[model samples]
Each structure stands twice: as structure tokens, then as C-alpha cells.
Target: MKNIFFILLSLVFTSITYAHEGGHGTPTKNWSFVNNNETIKADFIMKVGDMVYLSNENNEVLTFNYSEFKEQDQNYISEKANFINNLNFTKESHRLKTFDYSILLLLTGILVFVFSLFSWKTKPKKYFVTYNLFSASLIMMGCANTKSSKVLKMAANDIPFLESVFGVFNKVNTRHDDQYFYVESDGIPEHEMMTGITNWQQQVPVDHDYSGNNAWAIPLQPELAENTLSTKENFMKGAIAIAVNGIPIFNPLNNRGEDANVIGELDKWGGHCGRADDYHYHLPPTHLQTKVGEDRPIAFALDGFAVYGETTEELDENLGRFTSDSTYQYHAVKKYPYLIAAMKGKVELNPRTQAPENEIMPQAKTRGVRPDLRPLRGAEIIDFENPEPHQYSLSYTVNSQIHKINYGWDTDGNYNFEFVNPDGTTEKSHYKRN
Candidate 1:
């Protein structure tokens, strides 16, 4: 019975020594008076200036002015705020966690005294006493100077790191203001386009001026959203991310609510021409991994989260994981919503637009000189050729017959088009650039 009792006591001590390692407990206190003679129970998260953030019993995060609380609670909040301000959290290395050494020493002395008394009373064997002391020593040493789970949030993204990712492609240029890092390029990739598209629309790829006041903007400091916005029915109107090669990546689904890549609408590089003749990816261009390396980010979502190529870590529903204690980022997968399943960071949606077709503001805009065209049924785009300088031809086959659209432009902004019929007949049209 004595041996059993000692074993149980050691087990309890083992738990006590490590209980404070992972995290500290939060107490629910009456932070503010919601009504007369009634109060709201919330755990104080932290205080940022005058704002005191709290989590209610329902786990809902709430905020309020410190003055709104009772006098005693207000005093506690001020003391907490002052302690938080004095702590050095400027860098991850500086954020430290500590356990009271005095408490540990007190516990150690108590354990030794108890062991001595137990040995004297029970008259245990020499081997048992030695084993008990050794076991206790191991536990004490393990808890000595242990690091806790408290961590600091990452600082704002560095501009140089952003520059290096976009710099590998000569066609893309980058600049930054206080809040946003902007990228500019003519919206056409150096690789092939329009080939391997079985469900081709008659629209051809056009080079857009994705420069000047219309460049893509990525926030310098990303803020986590209170609730993540899912992508299934939202964000269908604008680009969700911008590729390192200066191309925009849209949602995996087309505006018609269909998987564009699986429907044979996308080319070999996972890109297709939109109704406005604008070329963009309906999925992540994972092929760019060869150029940017698999470890580095190949793109940045409009929500300002980095999009990495391949990862072995299990990702969350947002198609992302915390790369560090506080830095979270998205990764490319081989399934639907491959890049970002949702906007993991806070972004301002254009208020005028409604859900499923709403878009993030401060994004680049696109324009087309021609009207929207219907999809050419039974058409398969097999080849895109630049027959000569500034002149190009795109060929497609419908029912085993081939047709081509021969188009080109001049320095004066004048455009010309010749549509060659499969029956050896031809029709021509001309329009000047607006």
C-alpha cells in the first residue's frame, strides 16, 4: 500500500511540473456591466491602446473601451496593459517565457523532505529510495529553463523578399508604397497560350496594360480575418492571385460555376482566354515551380498571403498552414480550390459588387476592344503560331476540319483581322485601337 501510494504521488508531481509549459489558464471575469445588477463574463485577451479585447464564454471575440468596465476591473486592465508594453517583443528571439524559480525551489525542497520522511517511516529498501530520488531529479531537470509556447506575431513582410520573387521574371516589375506592394506587366506570358484547349472560346489572347495606376497590389502587413471567407461561391469576378510570370490567377471555377481546368477550357499551362480576350489562370500555374523553386512562393493572393508550390505538411481547410508560430501561408494542392480555399487574411471587397461575383478592390482592371463572344462548340484549339513579327495565327479543328484566325497590329494602334473558313473561303475585318 505504501509503495502504491508513493507511485501515485510521483505521478501527480510529474503532471504538476509540466502543466504550465504549453499555456497558461485564462479566467472568466465580469469585465463590464451589460445591464444593471448583471454582468458579462469574458476572458481578457489583450489591450491595444484604449481598446480591450476579450473572448466571451461562447468563444466569440469582442472589444470595448477600457473606461466601460468597473473601477476595479479598469485598474487591473491598466496594470496588464503596462506589463504588456514593457515586454520586449520586437523580434521572435526577444519574446521570452519564464517560470518562477523560487516556486520550483520550494517544490524541490518539499519533495526531498517528504521522501526523507517516507523512507524513515516505511523503512524502504536502499534501492527504492535511490530510484525515487533519481526519478524526481530527472523531472526537475527537465523543467529547468524550459521554453514556453508563448510566441510573437511576425513583422510586416520585407520588401526585398517580395522583390526577389517577382524579379526572376524580367517581364514583371515591382514597386511599393506604405501599405501595398504593386506589380506591373503586360498581361501575356512568355510561354505558349491557347494550345491544348478542347473547349475553346473563339476569343484570342490579348496583351493588356497591367501597368501604371492599374497594377496588382499586395498588402505589406496581412491581417487575419475574424472569420475566413470561403471561395466556393465568392470571389468569382476578379483574380484571386497574381503569378510570378505576371499573369493573373482566377478562381478554379469559371463564372458559369464550372471547373474550367477539368472542362478542357484551360490550355497546357492551365490558362484560358476570358470573354474579354484577357488571358488568366483558372488554377495555380504549378509548372512555374521549375523557375522559382518548390520551396519559394510562386504567387501572392489578393489577401496578401504567400502561395508556396509544394508542401508535405497537412494543410487546413483554407489550403494553408502556419509556416512559423505566427506566420501563416497558403500552399498549392492537386485538387479543387488548389491555391486558396478562402481569403485567410482581411481584404476589402468592392462594396458595389455582390457575393459570388464580388472582387477585392485596389486590383488591376482589364479592357477589351471587342464585344463578348459565345463559346465555339465542337472547337479544339490545337496550335498558336507567330508566323511573323507582330502577326499571329491560331488554328482549331471542328469535326475534322481546320480553321484559323490571322490577326496583327501596327505601331499606329490600328488592328486588322482575317478569319479563314475551313472550306477555303475567307472573311476580313478591320478596327482601329480606341
Candidate 2:
């Protein structure tokens, strides 16, 4: 009997030893292994026909057959192996599970005690139930408020950043003067819908002109030459470069002597003249010269509008047509020069028939009438066959050390538009201009 008992004990020991053999079958391709003091970790490609067996330090074996296991089982094995490999010397999942179980048990015990106390007396039962219910309700309310607070904070945090990214513009000044000028337009009457002139205020004086001082210089010579006045091209390019590459410089209008006339000319035809927010024409007038002889004919004031009539005779006839309208006439103020440069090649002899360069002119002249420059209204009938109108804005940075510029454009249909930096990088936004 003694011998049989010994044999049975040995057999049990042998079975455990066999089960504890720690290596898996041949360790499939790309397989790796790690043996910590507590667990043996195995990592391997569990492809078709792959079989793996794992053993803990206690000699308990776990076997996995890749072909037989479900997808979830395979994933679990992978995660388990990863956790084992990354385990630190001081922490393990087993310890976490034990702690969690302890906490749950403690909570259960407290709940039981509380239940017993309430059941001990019928009078106290309702009070106890109400107290516990109220406590739980308060906890839930606190948690909900905390979550809502976090959500609100996240929503509010990025608004300012987004506004800065998009860009912003504010009213800089306003003019109260009421003046009527001969604004060129398509054959349509001045009442037609357009975009550029919404809430348009009278032009402002640049500098000392408002101070009741005649010391402001006015331009005596405004003439057309191959390269006579500062071209809008060069001035606009410089302004844009400055805006994009450096800080912005707010240049006040020039009111000194001959500069005033230049300012006036620029106000009429320069600056960002489009209806959209992206178009930019920064050039305005700067200087003036007086004609002395045939080499220099009587120079028009810098602010004077260059009206082109049907013929040379008409041009001569209309030179002083609005002479009495002071607001419409040239003031010889030094204007912002950059916008003037952009106006070059943009103006046409007849705005209705002759298209402005780089613009989509209105078409479909019905009954010999066309639309003029007026504010756009939502749902206004537009001729889709014709090139849609557009608007543009200019932005630039100017610093002593660097300059940068970005020009933006918006199509009238709100189909396509882009903000283009001088460096050729572009950001696009979509909008529909009704």
C-alpha cells in the first residue's frame, strides 16, 4: 500500500512537470519570447497551422491553436503577450485585479450594513432610503456638470484663434460730405445691383486738409506718359509684399501741397475697388508737377479724373464738366500710392461695353441696358452665361526689415476664390455672392 501511494504522488508530480514545460511548439516565424519571474511571455506570428503553448512559473499550461481560435481570441493573446513583455518590476495586472476586487468587496459590505440599519426600524427605513437616494443623485449631478463644463471650455477655447486665422476688418473712418460724381458703369442705370459700393461713405481727407490750412500742397501736373506717374503695378506689388512679409503700416493720406491732388485721383480709381473682400488696389497718388512749356503742358491736378470720351473732341469738352462739384473734382491731396498702381489696366473707356482687365464683365444686355455698380442683394437675377462679378481685398505686412503681401479674390457666384501670398502659397475659401 505504501509503495502504491508513493507511485501515485510521483505520477502527479510528473504530470505537473510535463504541463509546466515552458516553450511553445517551434516558436513560429517572427516569434520572440521573454521569461519574467512570474510569467513566461511569447510573441509570434500566429499564421495558419501555428500552435503555441504558454506556462506560468507555477507550471500551469495554457495552449493556443491559431487555426482553432476566433479572431477575438487571437487579439487577446497578442495583447496579453504585449502586457507581459512591458511589465515593470513593481506592478502587474494581478495586483490591479486584487485591488479592484478588494474595493468592490468593501463597497458591498458597506451597502449591506446600510441596508441592515434601515431595516432595523420601519420608521427609519424611509429616511435611510431617501438619504442614500439623495446622495447618489448628487454624485450623478456633479459628474454631469463636470462633463458639461469640460465640453464648454473646449468649445470656447479656440474661437479667438479661429478668428485670427480667418482675418478681421473694422471701420477706420467715415466722411459726411455728400457729393455726386460721374461713376463709370455698364449701360444699366445706377440703380442696378452691384457689390462694391454698399454703405459707401464719402471720401476722407488724408492729413492737414481738414485743419483749415492752405499750407497743404496740391499737385499742379497730372499727365499721361509711358512711365509718367507711378504705375499702379509697382506700388500694389510693394504694398502686398509688405503686408504678407512684415508688419502693417497705416499710412495716412498725404495732404501736403501737390500731394493732395494725387490723393484725390487715387480715391476715385485706386485702392481695393472690387465688391468682394479679397480684391486689393493699394495705390493712391503721391506727388505733382507744374507744366512750364510745350515740353510740359498745363498739368492736371493729381486728383483729377482722366475721362475718356468717344473722341478726342469729347475728352476736351468734358474736362471741366463737373468743375463746380468740389467733391467730384480733384483736391490735389497725396493719396495712398499702392492702390493707384493696381488700378492700371483695370479701367476701360466704356465700363458697359469695354471690359476691365482681369475682371469678369457683366453680359446679356437686354433692351440695350446693362447693370451698373450697385450693392448686391440676395436672390437678384444674375446672368449665369456671363462672367460673374467678383471682389478682392489686399493685405500686407510692412516692417523695417521685411515685407510681405497676400491678395484675395472672390467670384460673384461664390464658386471659387483664393488668397494668394507673394510666395505663391494660397488659401482658398468658398462663398456665394447673391
State, as a TM-score between 0 and 1, how close model 1 is to the true structure: 0.65
lDDT score for candidate 2 against the true structure = 0.27
TM-score of each: 0.65, 0.17
Worst 10 residues of 2 by lDDT: 241-250
Model 2 Cα shift for residue 175 (angstroms): 27
The candidate that achieves the highest lDDT relative to the unseen native structure: 1
> What residue pairs are clashing in model 1?
none
Which regions of candidate 2 deviate over 4 angstroms? 1-182, 185-412, 419-426
lDDT of 2 at 385: 14
Could you give the C-alpha RMSD of every candidate to the true structure, in order shown? 16.0, 30.9
Candidate achieving the largest TM-score: 1
Residue-level lDDT of model 2, residues 207-252, one tens digit each, is 1111112111111222222111222212211111111101111112
Question: Deviation in angstroms for 233 in model 2?
Answer: 33
